[model samples]
Target: MKQRLIILSDLCGSEKSDWLIYYTHILNQKYDLVYYDSCQLGNVDTSSNDQQIIHQQFVEGGIRKAISQLIELEQNPIKILAFSIGGLIAWRYGLLTGNIKSLICISSTRLRKEVYKPKGEIELYFGEKDAYRPPMEWFINQNVKFEVIPNKHHEIYTEREFAEEFSLKLCNIQSH
Candidate 1:
């Protein structure tokens, strides 16, 4: 059986970004990939049609739902790739659920206290120019591997080449 990979996108979800397409291609080469768009999974109220409101809903409700889904899927340990606010969700969720085999986060802030330490390895990628970089203490205490992508923003991994390289790294983690 192939390994599983769950990818969580940022505020606007997978449709708004290219991360899904690129990463899915790479993961599909070696694993069965599952894509979860945080906005859609949480079923946040979008009646107002405001981007900020939608994003807020993702932070408040979507993250929780995403974590619950991951926990429910724990029968099959999977590698998770999260971007931006999605990364924040993954961190908190991983700490709480402790089911993922590995995690790769991009340009995310540490917003909540960690309740569960990850049993799997964690890789965090951040841009030097991103505004939301967390304090050194946060990363240092978590023991997460950090990578600085040059000239990247909050959405650095959205690029096809970047996603491909990232997916390869994720696959390697599962193999080892």
Candidate 2:
């Protein structure tokens, strides 16, 4: 049987997530995949394309609401591949539920605000050029494993090459 893997969308959610096919094409063969749109989960308005406006909503209360909704929806141990704001949500879910089998967060820059580390197997990937990404000291302080892809920017996960490489890595991890 295939393992269940939840994929959480970035802040822009499904509407702007055409890039998702890059990961799904490879991951689908190895895992039973589920997808969630962060905008819907967080009750954020997706009508506006302005990032600042969308982000403000999450900061106001969307994130908390989303976490509560997620807790209600999921009851079993989970593995997650989350991007951007979705990564933040997944991290909080791990902390709240303590039921994460594994978590992979990419370009989750908002994580810099978190003070506590969730209990689970976690890996964080960030682009070296992401100015908002947490500093190396943050990872060391949290005792979390992480990687920085040299010469890449915050949206590297949306790139086909990066997605393919990560999908392979994810497959290896699942096999082991």
lDDT of each: 0.70, 0.92
Provide the global lDDT of candidate 2 against the true structure: 0.92
All candidates: TM-score: 0.80, 0.96
How much is the lDDT of residue 148 in candidate 2? 98
* Residue 14 alpha-carbon offset, candidate 1, angstroms: 3.1
Those runs of model 2 whose alpha carbons end farther than 4 Å from true positions after fitting are: 173-176
Root-mean-square deviation of each candidate, in angstroms?
3.7, 2.3
The residue ranges of model 1 lying beyond 4 angstroms of the native Cα positions read: 46-50, 73-76, 110-117, 171-176
Q: Whole-model lDDT, candidate 1? A: 0.70
lDDT of 1 by residue, 39-110 (tens): 665666656667788877776777688667656655455688787777766766666766667887776654
Tens digits of lDDT, candidate 2, 1-176: 99999999999999999999989988998999999998899999989999999999998999998888888888889999999999999999989999789999999999998999788899999999999999988999999889999999999999998998899788874422
Mark the 10 consecutive residues where model 1 has the least summed lDDT: 108-117
